[model samples]
Target: MDTLSLTLRQRKLLHILQSHENLITGSELASQLNATARTIRSDIAAINLELKPFNAKIDSIRSKGYFFTAENGDKIRELNRINTAFFTRDDRIRYLAFQLCLTDTPINVYDLEDEMFISHTTLENDIHTLKLLYMLKSPFINITNQHSMLSFEPDERKRRHILTSLIHRHWNYNSRENAIYENEYVSEEILDQMIDIVSQCLHKHRLRMEDTNIVWLNIACTIMYERLSSGYMLPQASPVSKPDASALAASNEILATMERLFSISIPPQEYDEIYLLISSAHILDPSKITLANTCRIFDASVLDMAAEYMELLQEFYHLDFSTDEDFYLTLLQYIRFILAPVHRFSTQENPSISKSHLITELELAWAFQSIALKHAGYYLNEEELLHLAYCISGALEFHFELHPEYKLSTVICCHEHMTVAWSIKRKLLGAYEKYLKVTALIPVNQAKNYDFSDTDLILLTVHKKISDETLGKIIEISPYISPNDIRKLEIYLQSQKVSFLYRNTGSVRSFFETAYWHEDYEFDNIFSAVETLGSEFVDKGIAGREYLSALLQRESLCSNAYCSGLLFQFAMTPAKQTQLSFTVLPRRMNWRNHKIRVIVTAAFTAADRTLVFKLKHFFYRLNKQCDITNAVYSKDELLQLLTAQPDAHI
Candidate 1:
C-alpha cells in the first residue's frame, strides 16, 4: 500500500490501531476521533486493506469491537513519512497556484491527486472554485486547457501578484517555516547565497529593505528564475513607468550578480519588472510626510483638493485640522496611493458594505461629499471613505487627548409629569453619554427647594413664570425637544455668546407646540407627507411656495431614514424661517429603503445653518437607538423618550 495515497484521518487511524494492544470498541474509537461509529467501521475496513500488504489484520468478535495483530511494528512507523496531507485548503491552493505558474507545460490532475493525498473529486472541486473565485475576479490569472491537463497562463506582472499574495499568506517572519525552505523547488544553499548578494547590492546603492521584505524578494525572484530555467518565460510587461534612480541601480547590480551565479543573461525589460516589484515593497519612513516630500509625491491639484476638503470640514465642524500638518500630508499621500496604476499589494477585500457598521465614516463622507465634488469632481466610494475616516479619527483622538476638560453639565425641570421627565432623561443620557451629563430632574413647583449651584444649564418642558431667585440658568423647552436646543446648550456650556444659528430656548419650544403636530394628517409617500406639512407651514405664514420642492430635493440627495423605522426628513435652506412638524403614519409606508412609522420634518433657514449640523448629529446618534423609536406608541410616549435627561457629572 502507498502511504502517500492515504488521507490525514486514515493515517491517524493507523497510528491509533498500532498503539493499542488490547481490544478497542468501535464506539470508543469513534469518540476519540470525534467521528460517527459508522464512519469508524468504514475506516477500519480501509485500514485493513492497507495493512494487508504488511501481514497485519484487525480481528473482530460478535460481542466486542476489534483488535490489531501484526507481525512487525516498523511498517506502521513508515506511514508517518507521508506528511503532505496535513496542509490546509489555502495552503493547497497556494501550492497548486505556484506549481501551475512555474510549470512549462500542462500538469496532469492524477499526479496532484496522488502527491497531495486528495481524492480526484475534491481536487476537481477546488480547481473549479479557484477558476471562478480568483481567476475571473482578477485581471491576472487565466485558467487553461481541459480535463486531461491544466495550467496557469503565463504573464509577468500577474505572476508577481500571485507570488506576493502567496508569500503574505504563508511566510512566517519570526520562524524558519518559510515557503522557500518548505518547497522542494529551490535549495536552501541557493536561497541563502541570493539573499547575501541582494543585501550587499542594496547596501552598496544606499537602498533599505526590511529583513522580511528581503526574504519575500528573494523568494519571488527564486520562483521566477526557476520557472525561467524550465523554458517558461513570462510575457513582457506593458509600457513601463519611469523607474526610480536608486531602485534601478540596485536592480541592475542584483541582476549582474544573479547572471554570474546562474550563467544566463537577463533582458532589460525584465530588469525594469524586478525594479518595479522592489519599489512596490516600499518601507515607508515617517519623515516622508514633510512638506517638501509632499510636494514631490503628489501633483498640485491633489494638494489643492486636500486644502479645500480640510477647509470645508473646518467651516462646518469648527475644528481646524488643516493646521495639523501630519493630517494634511497623510491624506495627500493616501489619495496618491488610491490613484496609482498598480496597487502596492495584491487583491484586497472591500469592507463598509453595511451602513450601520461605519457610522462615523458615513457621517464624515456625507459632510464632505458636496465639497469634494465641487473641488475634486469625484465622490468618495466606501473604501476611500473608510480610509479617510481613519485619518480623521486618529487626528481627532490626538486632539482630544490634549484637551481632556471638554464636557457639559445639564439639569431638567418638568413639574406634574414624571413619565415625561424620565423619558427625556433616558434619551439625553443615551445620546450624549460621551460629553454631556444631567445633574437633576426637578419639579417646577419645587424648583426653589433644590440646590442649583453646580448646574450649568436648566431645561423646562413648559414655560411658566419663575422668579430669577428660584431659577438658575433656565431655558424653557418643549417635551419634544429639537436639536436647536442642544446647540444653544453647547454654546452656553463653552461660555461663548450664542450665535445667529441659535434661538432663545423659548422660541425653540414654541416650534414644537402641540398645534404643529398634525394628528389627523394621512400618511402616504414621503413626498405627499412633506407636501401636506409644507401647506400647513404656508397656511400659518411660516414658509413660502418653494418649501415642498426644497424638502423633496434634500430627500432625493440622501435617504432621510435616521433609524430603521423613523425618518428625520428636513428641508435645507428653505425660502422662509425655520419651523418643526411631525406626522405619524397610520400604516407603514416605504420611504426609500426605510419603512416609515414617523416623519419629523423641519423647514431649515439660513439663520440656523450651523444648527443643522447639530441636528444631523442628533439624528445620527438616534440611528443606533432603533428600539427607542419602535417602543413609542402614542405622542406622549414619543415625547418622553426624546426628552430623557442625561446623567449628572459626579
Candidate 2:
C-alpha cells in the first residue's frame, strides 16, 4: 500500500471514510476535516494512485462521495502492519524493559557486590547509573525493568553510535597517556602494577587495597583505553562495497517475507546496511568460530578459565549463560566484546596468533561462575544487558535529532474528549525540530475520522483496532498516510523505522495470549517480627526499625533490586531511615485500557511520598514489555507453593 507517504488532508478524509462501515460522503469528510467539499473532491482524485496496487478504486456517486473499492487478505495485512508499527517512546522503552530473556542471573549481582562489599542496593544503583548513562549516550536502546537489568537494541542508530564510540573512544587504559609503545605493550609501570596486583591477590587470599575485584580492575583498563585512544569505526554502509552490497542483499531477502506477508514496506536502505553489520559484527555467522581452526587462541587452561568466567558472570547477574541457544550468541558476543581491545592491541603480523592471555582472563571469570550457579544469576544474558545499554543511550541522545529522509506531521489522538492536539503537535515538532519541518492537530475523533493532507505518519493509543472498512477507506484516499496512536506517539517517532505506527491497546491485546490470570482472587504474603522458636528480641541488636533502617541505608547507598514487581519498603522497622517497607499488593488494575491483576507495591519512609515508584515503573514497563508484559502481569498467583518453614528472626 502507498500508505507511508500521504498528506494530512488526504489522511483526514481517509479517517472519516473508515469511521463509517457504510459508504461515506465527501461532504461528511469535508465536515470532519474542516475543509471545503470542493477541496475534498480534488483530494479524492489525487489519491487514486494509492488504490492502484489492490486493483481497487474510490467511488463518488453524486451524493456518495468516496469509499474504498477493494477487499482481500493483502489489504488486511497492510492495515495490520500499519496497526502494529505505531508505538510511543514509552512503548518501546516498555517493550525493552519487560523482556526478561536473560540466560544468566543472580551471580551478576553477587559478583558486583563481592567486588566492593556492595550491598544489593549499590549494585542496583550501578545498574541504574549505567542505564541513565547509556541512554544519554546512544540512539538504540533496551532498558529492561526500568532500572534492574539492561541491554542495547539492534538499531541502525545504535550501529552509528557504536561506530562513533569505537572510532572516537580508546580501548586500552593501562598505559601512560600518549606514550606509544611497541607491540601493544603498556607503560612499564602499568605492566608492573598489574603483575604486582595479581601476584599479591593470588598470594594473599585477599588484596590489601580498597575492596575490589579482578573484573573491576579489568574494567578500569578497558574504559581507560577507550577514553585515551580512538577506537575503529566501520565505514558507513552507504559508501557501499562488496560487504555492504552483500549485507543489503541478505537483509532484503530477510525483509522480503515480512513485507510480502504484510504488504508493508520498511523505511528504506538504512536498515539494510545496519542488519548486515549486526549479523556479521556479532560473530553471528556460525562460521566465525570455524576461523578458530586456523589458530589455537588458547590451550585447555584458557577454556577452563572461560568456564570459570561464565560461572562468575552467571552469579553476578543471577542468571545462567549456558541454558539456551540465544545465550550462545550472547556468550560469543560477550567473549568477543571482552577481548576486542586486547585483540586489536596485538601488533604482530599474525595478531590472532598471540591472543591467549585474553582467553585466560575469560577463563578466570568462568572460574567464579563454576562455583555452583545460584538461582538469582542463572538468567542473565548479553543481549539483554546490551538492551539495557541501548535504552540508556537512546534516551540520552534526545538532544540529537535529525532525519535525512521523510518529513513528518504528528497527530495526538488521546481518549480525552477535549482537544489537546495543538499542544501535542507543537511539542512533537519542537522536540524534533531538526527533522519535523511542519505540524498540525485536530480533535482525536476528527483526526481518527479524517487524516491529515500528506500526513505521512500518525500516533494513536495502544492496541486500538483498525477495522477493515476504516483501513480500506484510508488506503483508498490516502494509503500513503501512516497512523500513529497518540498514547505512545512520542516513542514511535524515535523508532528507526515504521512498518506500521499505531498501537491501540484495546485491539492489540489479542495478539498476546494470557498465560495465567484471576478475575477477583487475592493472595497474601505475611512477614512478622514476632519470634517463637526463639524469644522475640535476643539482643541480635538487629530487630525492628533499626535493622530495617540499616538495610535501607545500605540500599540507598548502593541501590537494591528485587525480582519482578517489588520495591522493598523496609522502613517499617528502621531508624537511620524513616519507617518504610515495600510490599506487593496484587489487585485488579487497568493500564492503557488493558486490565491486569498486579502487585501494586509501594515503599514508605516517614517523610517520603507513598511509593509512587511502583506505579511509575509499572507504566514504563507496560509500554516496553508487550511480549512479556502479560507474563509479568500474570505472575500474581498467591499460591503458597513452597513448604519450607519461615526463616528465624531475632
Per-candidate TM-scores read 0.46, 0.23
What are the Cα lDDT values of the candidates? 0.60, 0.34
TM-score of 1: 0.46
Q: Write the per-residue lDDT of candidate 1 for residues 1-650, one digit (tens) a residue.
A: 45624554555566566667777777557545545567888877887887788787777875566877878765555543343343545546666877786665899988988878999887886787667445854444888858768788766567656765555443444333342214445555666777787778888877766555667677666655665676655566675765568777888888888888988767666677678766655444657568777777767767877777788666755566755777777777665554444333321221312233333434555565655567557554444565566677666645544443443456788874788887888887675554446777778887767777665567777777555543436666667666556644543432211111232222233455543564455654566776777677777777776766656554544445534455666655444677777665556566543556666777766665454444444444444334443565556765665555222210
Model 1 residue 269 distance off true place after TM-score fit, in angstroms: 1.6
Per-model root-mean-square deviation over C-alphas: 16.6, 26.7
